[model samples]
Target: MRPLIIFILFYLLCIQVQAKTLQKTVNENTISFDYTWQDHSHKTQTLSFSLPKKLINNKYRRFKRYDKDKAMNHIYKALLEQASSYNPREVRVQFKQQYSQLSYTIKSKSEKKINEVEQKLKQLENKTYLDFLKQHHYIEFNTPWAGTKIKPDHKNFVIEGVDYLEPVTQAIRESISVKKPRVLINFVLSWLQSIPYSTLESRTESSGLGYYPPIRVIAQNIGDCDSKMTLMSAIIKKIYPRLSQSLIYLPQHALIGFQLPTLKTDKYTTINGLHYILAEPVGPAKYPLSEIADSSIGYIDAKSYFHEII
Candidate 1:
């Protein structure tokens, strides 16, 4: 009986030790995990953990240390991967305690569409930028417009504005047999021109200080020069992730430019040794790709400068 009792106690001790080792492993490696949902209200929630090393691994297993920025990126990618499988209504994420006990619910139609666009993007992941442009030039995008009243700060307007993804996706889906890169660009230019022009001053007077989100611009069917350029820029970046692009700012006007294989004009700007063809997005005035407005050309030549979008 004494021997049997000792054996039972030893077994229990082993099991407890195993559990502690597992918990220690988890607590020492994981930094944080995030949960995001896409429904009518776009929402994201993050749970943080303190650990010595980053637990997340890329496909190559290259990243093995915890970096706050890199970890956030990993979490976002993970959420995007999971979100693709859900319908465009309500998306949910739940994490077990062992994994970092977290739950996120996002309700936003626009967010769902964005996830769908991302899924489509995965199909072209292996293709080169030029190849992707050639293959998807004529794909038509069909996403309903959704407007937000929130004002965008300068930084928000430039780098982080993802609301444009949905409409841009829709535009890609709606594209017709556009084989050439120039022709594809024209399609986006035409779409921007179709939106009615509203000046920043006038928009601010009525709606207070805020830039329209790209999706909002589509829903409202009107935008200022900055808003229009922002929307166009977002679309261009989505299509050509590897291309060098920038924002050109004049005294009172803003435009975007892209680096192509060949230069169409000497009137271009160079950033990081890449020449970008200046393209105007604000129009009722028809300007071809790489053609700046005649009035703005001199201003651009004299006082315009470029800001690289990274």
Candidate 2:
């Protein structure tokens, strides 16, 4: 009896996984995606879009893995290589933990020698920091977003991911009969919301990559708040090239806001004399423009969230 119950649970889990798999039909010329989702009105809608196969092959041929320890090791090796380039007998550099913080210690035969070595190390460290981020395809960010400690390169995701999605954005634009800003934005949101929602793991976790870039999110048909926001930002940018945008990070969730006309009842934030009407694009729960998850309202109302211009 116990075995039967366990087997049933396993079967249910398998069904859930299979259901989330995106249905795509690939041909020599293009890859077509068919999606069905419910709109804010609780009405079911279907969308079909296709991407030129060549675009996928040429533009997003690889998915990058984000591993903090691996990246740190690479940086450490670089530092050691730089240090070895100096006369080992004259200068030595060591990394040590003091009061629960790690810092560099320099040793030399004389104070003058140590000072010289320190200057060189400083220059190398600065250059290495930027190089490591580039090599790892990450951008540095600091935020208090929930379930996050190491900053994921969300800026890189937004800026870079936007380029590959023009074909998709154009397809969406053509599908919508009404070209109104709200209408198009809501349509995009509903499509994203319908995709399987996967919780973003912490970067510190060794088991999974915490953040998914926009293209990866679409390819996998699963995303959390940050990933969806990144995709939405890219789509909105393509649709309205001149539109100003910002990404809002709440304690455990994320949302996007656009610099556009607003009404008295709209939820918005002001930056540099511009109004950004906030929109919640991360949904299995439909939130139309000017609406956000109830969980996020306290953070938004109290202004206790981080905001970044994209």
Candidate 3:
């Protein structure tokens, strides 16, 4: 009986020590992780961020099954949300089981630099507007005038614009050397917004029978929602051939969507096992890459398309 009692006490002491060690680990607030990847420019970069212990504990307890992959995905999703707020042009996250590690890469054009370019653009706005008018030979015509009616095969038109937008593609590549898709999309958005907005009826003078090619839209410096979205889609397809993109038809309006690895918000749709976030191209109002306007939500009827440059 004496030997048994001694054994039981020793076991209890060991249990207490183990529990204390676990408590110490759980109380730690941060986990250090190393991230390494190549940027859009093919330059290798490394960075780090603190993974919150609280998040891990909460997810672990809730998942109960404690799937490492699921837990890692949650971590990646959180990291994505945090990174996106800073408006990185591109971000990719991966998990490696060999080291029980997470790695990610971000390519972001500095906001300060973009802002400086914006200032310069603003300074030249008046001159640019005048130049556009003079070069395009602006003409004002009556709205809804009986212009020639032509039914556009929308898909074919968009596909054909791939070859037609070479000049615009060249201009984009030259102006912004960063090849990050999101940043390039934003750059396109800014350029489209710079053009004055006009309805198809107003510009074409043929109500409900007006569709212009992407190049025509650019040269004229005016277009409706669909025209701008078509231009954006063409430019994106030309530049990032591998990235998945789509045209979302919403009520009488149109928007663009791009497939991303993971999206935290409900404002997305899945296509062929990939997630795509909605982006507005017809904006005097600036919207982020995947964000839609408040008025445009819940009434959306989206369609997905994958265009190959070949």
- For residues 1-310, what per-residue lDDT tens digits would candidate 2 score against the true structure? 6999999999998567446435688888998887766688987767777777776666544645565566656666777788778787888888754443335889888999889888887887668767876766665555554343445567666777677787778778887899999899988988888787888665433223646678777766778888899899988987887889999877667889999899998988777788899898777788888887778888877878777887
Better candidate number, 1 or 2, judged by TM-score: 2
Please report, in order, the local distance difference test score of every candidate based on alpha carbons.
0.51, 0.76, 0.53
Residue 100, model 3: Cα distance from true site in angstroms: 70
In model 2, the clashing pairs are 146-251
Task: List residue ranges in candidate 2 displaced over 4 A.
Answer: 1-22, 52-65, 88-90, 94-105, 144-149, 203-208
Candidate 1 stretches with Cα past 4 Å from truth are 1-155, 162-164, 202-210, 264-267
Q: Residue 279, candidate 2: how far off, in angstroms?
A: 1.2
lDDT (Cα, 0-100) at 231 in candidate 3: 77
TM-score of 2: 0.82
Each candidate's TM vs. the true structure? 0.46, 0.82, 0.45
Candidate 1 lDDT, tens digit per residue, 1-310? Answer: 6999999999998566334322223345443222121111122211122322331232112311122243334444555565566664554433322243223444545776657555554443323322422222111111112222211233234444444364344445454365466666766675566455777643222222334545455534567776788777776666665766776655456778778766555356666787777777877665668777777787656544435463
Clashes of each: 17, 1, 0
